[model samples]
Target: MPSPSPILLAPMEGLLDFVLRDVLTRIGGVDRCVSEFIRITGTVLPDRVFLRYVPELLNGSRTPAGTPVRPQLLGSDAACLADNAAALARLQPEGVDLNFGCPANIVNRHGGGAALLDTPEALFDIVRAVRAAVPAHLPVSAKMRLGVRDASLALENARALAEAGACELVVHARTKTDGYRPPAYWELIAAIREAVAIPVVANGEIWTVADAQRCRELSGCQALMLGRGAVADPGLAWAIRAADGQAVSGAVGWTELLPQLDAFWRIISHHFPGRQRVGRLKQWLNLLRRRHPEAEAAFMEIRTLTDPAAVDAWMARQRA
Candidate 1:
């Protein structure tokens, strides 16, 4: 078979701020990045929100380091979604990603996100509405989990997205009921892939290059989308591209690690302006904690450090 394509980074709300996005992209492995969902409830999302989440639009679809970054929108109202999509298209971001897949309860309770799966007709309506509004050349895609409570409606829902003009559909395999807790059913992704003719991207449970390889073979997907896995190992897509069985092995050096961490802090620091630096770093450090068990000591060491001076001092001590 031809070489496997590069992996796309699945956006995590709050977790994927401009700082983290920049840091990860500069690490040189992520294929494409999606901005955190610009929530569009019934109101059209403001251009500032779109620009804030997807600065890559200003940089020609690439992250600060030049990796493609697509803007994503979350909303239920079809016309509002279409209008926001049209406005966002003005920036020429890669494409608009409709988030019918987010299973967050707050989003679901609002009759948006995965709750739309309960009414696949509505899902089709949103997809069709947005697809029709976007320029003919621009691509539109939808991301979704299996369904509300079970797999019974997964195929039908997947097909609806395709029939409604989604250029591609990325399926997370498990139902919304499964949420992030995994044992992600790649078989279901395979089922969805087979159910629709549009390119299907498999997501979930892809923690390592080996898992991605196996998932690609199992799901028979046109591409793979990495979520927490990429967050845990920033070099994941690079390692997978190299096809090294030990791609999961540490390619990140301590020296390289600091710069990326600094970059993340820089963006957070910029956003929060008056907010405490230690607190900013701590949020990312929490996610980074999942990868480095030793980060427990690091978190404890810096937990109380609020300002930049304290944060700088704490890091200095840790390095020493």
Candidate 2:
């Protein structure tokens, strides 16, 4: 029998920040997490910039739940990214991950993220440079999509990253053109896995235990990285593990999630300003409604709330 695969928490830039990472990891079952990408432009960023994006660096690069978080860097400049990676390595992160998969228009227009897929050689240079900059003991991993417009160069891009010293790869299973649509082509991930020597993790459109099973079967990858699905259902990782015969608890229902929601509210309230606090809670509640019917009612209750005190009152009512 093969060993059970590691389940990773994906880096979702505005959606999943340090606060949510803390909340979800506390719910248990995620093996590791990648912090939201810290965009590297033409200059090397300071340690504070990396810390701002991944405060886990200050906690020995692990969340409060002790789950390791590898910071991800997104940019097109090989030299600048390497310099920043070297600076980030000085803080002694668990590892560094490159982002070649973001589909955001602003990111692609800047010659970063999914746009790099159009030029596999650039991917190779970026990875090779960062790999050389970071210490040998620290792993250099990467995440990428099939391509900007299609899956034509998926295997070539995967091979380029692996050959350039990326220790692992996460394939999002969709192109920039796909843009979070249905029917993520898991079969294409299988081919990329066969072409690469390092471990490959399957990602994109996995929302349930059944989806997890089918993706693993089709992609032939034991590992997976959960994104929107995990946000919608925080218990997803544990549920998937339970289905895999692991000695873990099963799916977390609405009642069990209430306290986690409260904890999330408290953190955001303290860290974010009034408007942002409301927006962040609404953002999460919006996604949670997909998995929990109760969230729909909860969302409606607070949909009209624009003041922080009113949101607090709403939270208090939920607790009551």
Candidate 3:
């Protein structure tokens, strides 16, 4: 590993919110975390949106636990993105990251996220403009896929991004067509790393500490950005940091997991009280489904409970 370790929390839009970020960073090993993409279409998003996600900017550019939290932006208009970058600079974040990798239908259709990759010329112009807007001390980085459809354009796209003055790039190593499927082919990240001048962070399919190690060795990039892997096991970062032969944390059974799960809902509940709270819980449950069979049952129970207390009770009963 590279000194303190090189794991970063991926900039997952809805999933990597403020509280979730807090939880993961506290896990001992994660060095950096990027807030969900702040969509800047032209209008400057309110300060609350920035502080709500990037509270770290308030205290020197690093998250409360000391790991840096870079704010990410997603949009198509170069001028708008440049303006947004300039505006956010006043906050003095450690860095700003460009989101050229989001595959969401809404973002793609608007030509804001991954859709820009389809037009490499536009992508080049946007990155160059944003680089010009941000201060030299603050790094401008990017996260991208191999291509929108197949992995054909990965090398060329990576070269264009690097040549455009981006400080570094994180290659997710899969085409947009792969979505979040298996076999992320981290080896492709090695190819991009060799092709670029700046540091390349390897992302995708890193579920365990061994996986991270293998990714680094196979991709020749020790820097890793965790997406779903971090979501499934929030303690992963700390484990990776310890760098021991032992697994960092133990698996919680349904019995022991209920209280922690219930507590998380409470935190989310505060932000989204009532219907707002319920919606957030549902979204989190969707991620839990991949790791917990009872997540489906808990989600079904919570879907109609409406009452937060009742939802907690139902979730508790899901214990194995």
RMSD of each: 2.8, 1.5, 3.5
Best by TM-score: 2
Q: Rate the local accuracy (lDDT) of all candidates.
A: 0.79, 0.94, 0.78
In candidate 2, residue 184 scores what lDDT?
Answer: 95
Instruction: Give the distance in Å from residue 165's predicted Cα in candidate 2 to where it truly belongs.
Output: 0.3
Question: Whose lDDT is higher: candidate 1's or candidate 2's?
Answer: 2
lDDT of 1 by residue, 1-320 (tens): 22256468887886776667888878866667777888996766676777778777778977778777878888899988998888888888788888988889999998888888888888898989999888988889889988889888888888889999998888887778888887888877888888898888889888887888888888987488887787777766766776744244447644567767766665666677534556667876776677666555677777866677767666665555
After TM-score superposition, the amount by which residue 275's alpha carbon in candidate 2 deviates from its true location, in angstroms, is 0.8
Ranking of models by lDDT:
2, 1, 3
Q: How many clashing pairs does model 1 include?
A: 0
Q: What's model 2's overall lDDT?
A: 0.94
Give the TM-score of each candidate: 0.91, 0.98, 0.84
> What pairs collide in candidate 2?
none
Q: Candidate 2 — worst ten consecutive residues by lDDT sum?
A: 1-10
Off by over 4 Å in 3: 1-4, 242-263, 282-304, 312-320
